[model samples]
Target: MKMLLLRYSTAFICAVFIITGAVSGEDKAVGQTVSFRPDKIVTPVSSIIWKHRSSTGSVVKAIEWDVDDGDNIPNPRFKGITTLDQKTGEITITKLTVEHSGVYTIDINSKEHEQRFTLNVMERVPKPEITIEESSNPDVVYLRCAYSEKIIWKKSSGETLNGMKNQDPGEFITVKNTRNPENFYTCTLKNAVSEEISDPVTERELFGTGEDKAVGQTVSFRPDKIVPPVSSIIWKHRSSTGSVIKVIEWDAEDGDNIPNPRFKGITTLDEKTGEITITKLTVEHSGVYTIDINGKEHEQRFTLTVMERVSKPKMTIEVSSNPDVVYLRCAYSEKIIWKNSSGETLEGKKNHELGEFITVENTGNPENFYTCTLKNAVSEEISDPVSEREIFRTGEDKAVGQTVSFRPDKIVTPVSSIIWKHRSSTGSVVKAIEWDVDDGDNIPNPRFKGITTLDRKTGQITITNLIIEHSGVYTIDINSKEQEQRFTLTVMERVPKPKMTIEVSSNPDVAYLRCAYNEMIIWKNSSGETLNGTKNHDPGEYIMVKNTRNPENFYTCTLKNAVSEEISDPVTEREIFGTGSNAGMIVAIVIVVFIVIAVIAIVLSYLIMKTVHESVNNICPCIPNIFGPLDCLLKKTDREPKNSAPNDVASPLNETAP
Candidate 1:
């Protein structure tokens, strides 16, 4: 048995370390094998002695071994179960029982060694199972384990939790919802020697829903069909898993009785009406609540589901330019509605059910104000009103000395008259273009006379040769009626085609590039992917060449403005920094240096060999061994004497000591 343990000694120790943390005093379950190794010095001893000390300090000699003699077990209790190695002084005990737990020590020769071990033998832990107490709100729940020993809670996500306390000793633990219903939870019962984990439980398995209610809310169950002066009223609850418990019971003579402790203080029963009210609800209160009036069971029952309060939602706006449509989006997924200024629900305006957004057409009415309401079973919130002007105002940017057309949202054919008015930045309004069915087009302002034209049929106005002074809001009128949708334009100087300038910095691996424009610069590679380089004040940007890995890719800088954009000519890193020529030169220099080093090494080695050869020839010329300088010197002294040695060759003592 000792030999068998020795074969797998390394594996046994590793297993113990992984299970028990390899402490000096390790814990083990009953019916297991334990090896006590002498951690101190065990060598140069003529004999080895092992002893056991109990918890009461009583000591007994377990085993003794002699290097020359055999081994003996002094304690008969350890005779068949314990074994000690005579060579290594290691002790092994198999099939351990609780009585074998105590302090153990080994003695080298006669004196005890410093190394001491403690063994704890205990029974295996029993596997525990979890019990659940439901809550009215899914966010809070109570879980239970029955073990009184050390308890540990664990999430399936490998999250370690601090030690948890049981609300009722070893029975209940309050668990707040972490909003991760997919993650499962388990509890472990641990002691000094053993630990066992319970099966996992998830929120979905613990809670179910029907009619939802919020925590701290109240709910009533009524069964008033019985005649006045009812004899009994009983309210019973059945959990989703089919467990039945009494919520409240009342008898005309016995008064009221709330059997379950979970509903004691907060549950009420009205005798005359047979109505049961439960307030300050928790997730544990969620279940099917049924009532019986005057000893007669009512078929009607209520299934209550508890949930967290819904969050308030915010409304967002998105405007489509081409179709001129406004989208009102509520930031919530469900229970969304849109209302107008008169508080009338706009039905049929919902774009789709998947996305909580509704479309508002460009009705050209400034009074088109809308609000979105987001609601859940527990709460509702209405967004602030959004006006149509905020949604329908169209903005356009034009460059100076450029032509632009101001077209209405819709075309009005066979127009009687058309007028285009401009509101300048100073709030001054003027007619820029005017036309009538009886007369041709006319420009009212001298600055716009030769540059503006109005389309008589479509009521569209075109302004040519724009300048910075033309920047303002333009409103259109057709058939003597003004439209609500207006156009806001801003004119600025156009961006010039950027010129790329490159400057190599002191660092050989990087170069600085400048676009020579004041506008925003975007650097892009040949693949059009944006490049983020270190920013510089004057030289624009500092980009790495060698570290980029693709030094041959062409790069361009795009200068942009609200009105126009231009891109600089593409340039490669190699062209900017001349790294290609520099790399070739560096390679050539390294090759030359290596060649010089090789030639110098060869000459030095040849000189050293020549010097050694000359010294060997001067010391002894009769030696012919040249494989090594040392071999030649040793051979010269050990050469056989040619005059005599026939007897010396045959004698064993004459052979050289190797």
Candidate 2:
């Protein structure tokens, strides 16, 4: 009985230890989320209850849910921060704090599950800093860390110093001066939840480091040491070719002086510290610099390489004969790099072929953008983003007489050279317009002589007074790269307005109506019905119609082409007949009136002539002479005896006339 009791007690204690060891715990930073899930699967009808034990050992029911009653949280503090999943029996707490850190347990269907969680919320460790302190030895210093938590010392390469992982909480560590320019160190504050690392400090920063500068940049050089009340200071520069130039000269009484003309206006000197600063540096200012104090040179010398800033890069695209390949060339530079839209560097030989330019395959995706960067030691410039889609475009359809303009998707400014070509419908190509920096616009084809205009800056061509012959493919080449996009144009003709005319036959009742236009003609009556007509002299130029006396029976002629249509003014049949009859009657009346007036004038002329002749005979009884004077008057004046009988008759006539 004693052995049985001892074995049962031991078994009970072992079971309790196993149950306690089943709970899980994790360390979470402040403001982080933690989740506790039940070990067994949860069903819709299963009841769930969640409870939490605070750090102070107080227990409380946090949430309760079942199929009958939805879900309820008793504690208002956890109202917004806690979420419960009824189906999965998962409890999630967000934005956790130290006050909320405790053990969490879930009971499903009135039975506590084996799954348990303990959350330990902690704040992030403070960032560690290395405070340097002077040691008694001249060649050594003490680097002290400042943090409440564990300290981790690392070199610039991220390796632990002296192969030590986490160091015990300590204040300072001794370091010997190595005089190596590549030496750098950092410290980190680490905890269970989070860690913070300090910025890297280099040994050269404590000493002095050489600098590289570009044009228009400023630089300062400080000596290693300077005695108080320095008598004289001189800053000197030595070029790479071993030529020395006096950069600055200063004295206690004589002030400062800069002898070099290149550093006259842009150089400054500190007399007390023997320090010199050069502003607005140029490439010519590149050299080894040093300072002198009290007739003795400073210990350290600074070497500076002043380079020119990189020029702004320009991108040019060239399309290959293959539709899927394109070449991108950047402005000339010693070093070039290519990048995609996502800012990832592309492999040189794998992703693109390297030559004078970069060649890439067009995958027909416009989202794949590329940029080129021109880089040197001092500066870099990136070109604008370019895509293959921007280098090619589709065609447009246009009307026959429209003034059309062909604009490229991408316009290269400051264009050095450009050429515009056209492919006719018969597969013949010709240069429409060309221009270059040396020569102005030159139009080679006579057809485009007066109508084509090319833009020098945009590489665009505008063709005015467009004709049917201009309906072909047009292309442009800028800086020797022919564009793949073709401006295909289809020109259609427009119909003109139609005119109607009437002609009369020999018969009074017969009249013909004609419609005049150089296109398909449709004849419509007043009832809006199509009429058939015989073809006229030319195709689609004329239409015929018969004349009707009805006033309401009006006719219209419509001229139509593939692109346009126009209708003539409505004309009535009675108007047509009236036109012919009125014209004929007017002619007949004009002829009859003219003949009557002519006959009356002839009768009056004859009567007047007879009266005149009788009067002449009564007056002189002789005819008038044609070339000479009257013969009877002449005879009467010449001889009176021969004209005695005439004189006696004339005397009786003259008396009667008087």
Pick out the ten consecutive residues of candidate 1 with the lowest summed lDDT: 649-658
- Candidate 2 residues 435-479, lDDT tens each? 988989899899898989987877779988778888788888998
User: Per-prediction RMSD in angstroms?
Assistant: 27.5, 47.7
> Count of backbone clashes for each model?
9, 0
Off by over 4 Å in 2: 1-27, 30-123, 130-212, 215-229, 238-246, 250-284, 296-303, 314-368, 376-378, 390-658
Least lDDT summed over 10 consecutive residues: which range in candidate 2?
347-356
Per-residue C-alpha lDDT of model 1 across residues 1-658, encoded as one tens digit per residue: 5468656876886777755653368688898889888755556878888889988889998888877877888897788999987666789988888878898888888888766788998888799999887788755777888778788888775656664665565756677754334557898888887889999997556542235678899987666366776788889899868899999899878999999999989999878778788899998888788777777878775667666665666667876774457678876665677788777777534454444777788665556788877765666777778887677676667899888887776865667888899999999999998887788777888878888887666666788899999999999888889998788878999888888777776666666666766666788888878877666676455455442434577888887887788988888866866544455557798999999999666545535778755655554445444344456567757875433364743223234423
Clashing pairs in 2: none
Candidate 2 local lDDT, residue 594: 100
Model 1 misplaced stretches (Cα beyond 4 Å): 1-206, 214-248, 252-373, 377-392, 399-403, 407-419, 425-429, 435-441, 455-459, 476-484, 492-494, 533-536, 539-551, 562-564, 579-658
lDDT of 2 at 284: 86
CA shift of 141, model 1, Å: 11
